[model samples]
Target: MSGEDFEDALKYTLQRKGWKLSTTKKTGDFGADLIGHDPKGRKVVIQAKRWNSKVGVDGVNQVIAAKAYYRADHAMLVTNQYLTNAAFELAKRTGVEVWSRKRLNAEIEANIPSKSNK
Candidate 1:
């Protein structure tokens, strides 16, 4: 999928989970893609990536950098593909949440709004 589509899904999933979503539009920038607050007002920073292949440790490093740069209380990396072993290890070591496509889709599905009420 395209980067924009992945970003939209990430925002939708977060919003459904009671997080406020904000976006940043930039090219070749080092900032996180979105900033948000949880239902209890905890700070969050998100980086959405649309990679046709596996995401590596470099992606995790960038997320970590952005998290620190923004002073966010929590951080997540939402990607369209699975992360490499190195990437997962890095995220684990740094306490960053990595959402793969399958996991992300499950979150989205679980939180999907019922159409019956609308």
Candidate 2:
């Protein structure tokens, strides 16, 4: 999937999870790709990566900077490919959640209505 596809999927998943979603705001320069809010209005900063190869820690660092810059309550890194070990370590250290393709798929599935009922 392309970067845009991943972003779209992320937005869809968030909405399915009952989040209030917004695109990159023009006036607010969070340096992050997307901004979401939970039912209680907690901020969620999302960084997207649709790389053909594994994403390294640099991408994670960039998003981390954006998270601090934005003062978000929580941050997530969503990628089509897997994150490197260094990236995982960086995310763990920075309190950013890393969601790989498999994780994303599972989350999407869990949020969706059961096929048997639907």
Candidate 3:
């Protein structure tokens, strides 16, 4: 999927998980792709990356700045591909939730209604 598509998918998944989402403008977003409140009402800022190769620390850095810019309580980086070691380390140290493909798929799967239930 493209970057915007990835962001939309994540927004839908989060909405299903009870987040109130607000997508940023296509340009000059100040590094935020999605901004919203979590289930418990804490403000959250998210940066979504769709890349062919491993995602780097730039995504983490952007989300961190986005969090500060938005004054959000939480910051997260979601990527379709895996994160680099440096990205992971930085995210861990900065309390930025990094949702790589595995976790992203889990969240998607968790929210998808089973066919049997449909």
Please name the candidate that would achieve the greatest lDDT relative to the true structure: 3
TM-score of 1: 0.88
- In candidate 3, stretches whose alpha carbon ends up further than 4 angstroms from where it belongs are none
Residue-wise lDDT of candidate 3 within 1-118, one digit each (tens)? 7789999999999999899998999999988999999999999999999899998888889999999999999999998899999999999999999899999999999999899998
What C-alpha lDDT, on a 0 to 100 scale, does residue 36 get in candidate 2?
69
lDDT values of the candidates?
0.83, 0.80, 0.93
Point out the higher-scoring one by TM-score: 1 or 3.
3
Residues 1-118, candidate 1, lDDT per residue (tens digit)?
6687778878888887888978766664455888878788978788888988999988888879888887889888888789999999999989998888898778878988789867
Error of 3 at 70 (Å): 0.6
* Clashing residue pairs, backbone N/CA/C < 3 A, model 1: none
Better of 1 and 2 by lDDT: 1
RMSD of each: 1.6, 2.6, 0.9
Could you tell me the lDDT of residue 109 within candidate 1?
85
In candidate 1, position 88 carries an lDDT of 92
Highest TM-score against the true fold, candidate: 3
